[model samples]
Target: MRIAVISDIHGNVKALKAVLDDLAHQAPDAIVNLGDCVSGPLWPEETAVLLRDLGWPTVCGNHDRVVAAGNVPQDNRTDSFTEAALSAESLDWLRRLKPAIRFSDEIFLCHGTPRNDDAYLTEVIDGRGSARTADEADILHRLDGEKAGLICCGHSHLPRVTHLPASGQTVLNPGSVGLQAYSDATPTPHVMANHSPHARYALIEEIKGTWTFILRAIDYDWQSAAQTAAANSRPDWAHALATGRMQDGA
Candidate 1:
């Protein structure tokens, strides 16, 4: 079976469009969207409607939680005043999303950790050195311990896969389609501006007894998207989109 894993789409309709267009060639069995679908630069209403049309399996995220609460964070302001607005319907969709999903004995999905919807698994926090149990640590820790063969997730906005020799689990994070936090180059125009703005995603293929996790990055019309953000009144978010960085590194 083949599956595409995607997450952290924070609006940026152009990136999502480019990714979908590219994925058409692969024709995977199904696509799994790991929430945070519409909460950034582009129009959340448009982004949410489009993702709903895709009809992919999904999970909820922290940004979705904020949208649901209908109250933006007070101190955690990342974007300038211009770029943090969201539509009412968009917030409604986010509030209704689920947190985690399980698939078969070998596959599980979540926006963050199984324990909490808002917990993030970055290299620093969940690295091998900090992990405790085999299945309960980070993604790699859980994958190795569960021996479920494969586990996919998102939230770090960093695309990566780790193989644990101790328990034989392969953990994968497909990164963000809208905002990428960890990159080869730090985005500079916003935060990691030097980084490239290629929408990233993942393709999981189980052939025979072997499983392959493929990371993909595709080019989108980020310039136009940024321009749109500037026009819409959220220049900070728009700049982050073009630079591939988040306002608060979330």
Candidate 2:
């Protein structure tokens, strides 16, 4: 069986379409979306409509929850913009999404850690406001004793594949499809950058009880997306869209 995984769209339908085009050629048996579906300066309602039509198995991300709640703080421009742009129906769709999904006995899907949508799963924020790959002990602790052989999560927007040698379990993060780089200040001040503006996703296949996976980055018209962000008064998002880095030096 083969499954394609996408996450953290954060609007920007252009990137989503590019990923979809790539997936058409890849032709996986199933597709799953780890959310953060539409919360950015880009086309939230349009992206939400497209995702609703696709109807892929999806989980709610932190941004999804914030946008759906519509009680966004004034300082949260991303969620506030998304909340204002989304229709009532779209908000309802996000509200109905689950935080985690048991795809199968062997596969578990979640936006972040199974316990917390706002927490990082495979990475940790350091003292210098940067992200570092989490050690095995930390990763296992975050797993919280979930026994699925294959675990899939997103939130850090970094593409990674980790294997726990002791338990023979694997964790996969397909990365962000729309916005690739971002800065956060919740748990700590930190940034995540893919270092290039490319839409990302992952494909995993199970053969003879062994699971294999691939992380993909596909090129798209990021310049246009950046322009859209700038027009929406989010130069930070524009820079991330154009360069996949939070700033000039990042």
Candidate 3:
């Protein structure tokens, strides 16, 4: 079985369209979304509508939860923008999403960690916002004894595939389909950047009892997306959309 995995769209519909176009050719057996779908300065309602129509298996992301709850903090401008843009129907759809999905007996999906949508599963972010791949022990600890052969997650928005030798489980993060880079002030002050404005996703296939995967970064009209962000009064998002890098010092 082959599956396409996408995550962290963050409301950039142009990027999402580009990814859908790419997927039309790849044509995997199934598609799964790891959430963080519509929380940006761009087209939240439109993105949500498209996702709802597609009807892919989806998980609720941390931002999705924030938007669905309708109690966004004043400081969270992204979630606030999304909340204002989404209609009641869109918000309800988000509210109904689950934090995790067992796609199959061998496949498990989550937006971040299994127990925490806001936590990182495969990456560790320092207090300064720099991120590094977590060690095997750390990843296992975060897994909390999840026994699925294939574990998929997104949140860090970095494309990665890790194989845990001890448990023989593979973890895949397909990266961000929309916002490739951003700065966040959460558990710490930090930035996540891909260093290039490419829409990213992953395709994984199980064959003959082994799993193989590919991480893809597809080109799209990022300049238009950047201009949309700037028009929405988010110059930081514009910079990230255009250059896939945070402005100097962010």
Candidate 4:
């Protein structure tokens, strides 16, 4: 079976459409969305409706939870922005999303780690402004008792494929579908950037019990997305969406 995975699309419908257009060319048996679907300064309602119609198997992310609760935390206003934009139906759908999906005994899907939706499944923060891969042992420890042969997760927005030789498990992070660069101060202040305005995702193929995956970062017209962000009083989002760079003045 071949599966295409997408994640972290924090509302930019332009990016979402670009991803869907790309998927149409690389058709797979199934598509799975790892959430954070609509919670940003971009087109939250439109993106939510699009995903609702697409009907891909999905799981909730941290932002989804905040939207469901209709409460913005201290640092981010995504919850409020999304709450105002999303319709009742869209909110209900996002609220009802499952935390995880076990496609089979061997395949599993989640927003972040199985145990923590906000946890970084595969990333380690190195300092005040960067994120990197965790140590192998650390990865294994965070993964803990997860025994799925193929584990798919997101939340960090960095595309990566890791094959753990110790447990014969392969983990794939398909990357962010919409927002490419973001600065988060959740656990600490840090930034993530793909360095280009690209729509990103991945494909996983299970052939004869062997799992192989590929990450794709495809270019898209992000100027429109940036315009929306700027209109929403979020020039930081505009700069990040347009350039995928974290500059102070953007």
Candidate 5:
């Protein structure tokens, strides 16, 4: 089985379209969307419509839940923008999304941790209270003994593949398709950065019961993507979309 995975498409239709165009060529057996689908100042409605049409297996994300529940973060102006941008139908669809998906007996998909939609599955907070790569034992602890051949997750907006030599379970994060960088306060204030304006995703192919993975960062019209953010008064998101780097000191 070949699976194409995407996550954190925070309302940037341009980036999502670019990634989907690339996927058209790859023709993976299944396409999995890891959510955080539309919670930015960009084209939320358009992005939601496109995904609805594509009809892929999707899991709910933290941002999606906030919006679906009409609980936009108090400090997050982007969430307010998203709430207004999405239609009632789109919000309803997001509200009904599964928190996790078992694509097959071998493969599982989730936005964050399998148990907590908000928890980081393979990342952890450091002594500084900032998120960072987790140790093998820590990762395993978070897994809580759930064993699948492949566990796919997102939410840190960082692309990574970890093969637990002990469990033979591979955890893959496809990274962010939109919003390349953002500062978060959960698990302590920290920033997530891709460091380049590229649409990111991943392809996993099962070969003889083993897995081969490819991480993709496809270039798109990031300038326009940034411009949209700027136009909507989210210069922070604009900077990230343009350079994939947080605005200096942001």
Candidate 6:
């Protein structure tokens, strides 16, 4: 069977529409959305409604919980769009979301870490990778041996595919559909329209006895998404939408 794995769709309806249209041709058996479904420059309510209508199984993202709670700290407000999206209704949905979901004997879905539901599995930074090495590895190891054959997680907003040979598990992050946020030595990668937008997702195909995880990036109308951010009085948000940079080079 084939499953389309999507994650971190942060309220960019335009990009989501493009992705849905593109994936339709592939004709997957199911589409599973790993969370961070709302809280962005665009209309989050519209995005939530669309996802609900599509019957996508979703988990709670960190920001999605903030929206559902309507309790974002004033200092963390990156843009006006962020401020506007925090509402009671959004919080309600987020509160209702399950932290982890088991798809089958082989597949599992989650927003953050399997150990702690609220953990943010950020990539290693500085020498911290060495000191914190065992922390990351241990969780992955446990998940591999006991949880499911394939473990998928969102929330880092970075795209990656890795195989845990010891545990016999494959872990994947499809990145962010709305915001890419893959910063390294470079400021950010500017993807042209011809290139599939910075927007990325994954396609899981089980052919024969093998499981393949293919990470796909698609280019969409980022400018329009930026415009939507600006119209919502979120210029910084628009800038972030166009550029894949994250806060503090995250």
**Candidate 5 per-residue lDDT over residues 96-138, each given as its tens digit:** 8998999889888888888878989988867654567788887
Backbone Cα, N, C clashes tallied per candidate: 11, 0, 1, 0, 0, 6
Root-mean-square deviation per candidate: 5.6, 1.0, 1.0, 1.5, 1.3, 5.2
**lDDT of model 1 at residue 174?**
92
In Å, residue 143's CA in model 3 sits off its true spot by 0.5
lDDT value, candidate 3, whole model: 0.94
Candidates 3 and 4: which is better by TM-score? Answer: 3
The local lDDT score (0 to 100) that residue 49 gets in candidate 5 is 93
Off by over 4 Å in 6: 78-91, 127-146, 182-197, 246-250
Query: What are the runs in model 1 whose C-alpha is more than 4 Å off?
Result: 73-90, 125-147, 182-194, 232-235, 245-250
Each model's lDDT = 0.68, 0.94, 0.94, 0.87, 0.89, 0.69
Candidate 2 lDDT over 48-98, as tens digits, reads 999999999999999999888778987989999999999999999999999
> Candidate 6's residue-wise lDDT over 1-250, tens digit each?
9999898888887889878988988888999988888767687777877887787778777666665665466655532355465455555666788777888888888876665444545343343221122244755644534558788887666677767766777777777787765232211322211112367788989989789888887878888888887887777567667765433423
Candidate number with the higher TM-score (1 or 5): 5
Clashing pairs in 4: none
- In angstroms, the error of model 2 at 30 is 0.4
User: Lowest summed-lDDT stretch of 10 residues in model 5?
Assistant: 124-133
lDDT of 5 at 23: 91
Clashing pairs in 2: none
Q: Quick one: ranking by lDDT, best first? A: 2, 3, 5, 4, 6, 1
lDDT of 3 at 150: 94
lDDT for model 2: 0.94
Pairs in clash, predicted candidate 3: 129-190
For candidate 3, report its TM-score. Answer: 0.98
TM-score, ranked from best to worst:
2, 3, 5, 4, 6, 1
- Candidate 1 C-alpha lDDT tens digits along 83-195: 25555655566667777777668887877665555554434432322222223345444333344566677766778786766567667889889875422221112122215
Better-scoring candidate (lDDT), 1 or 3? 3
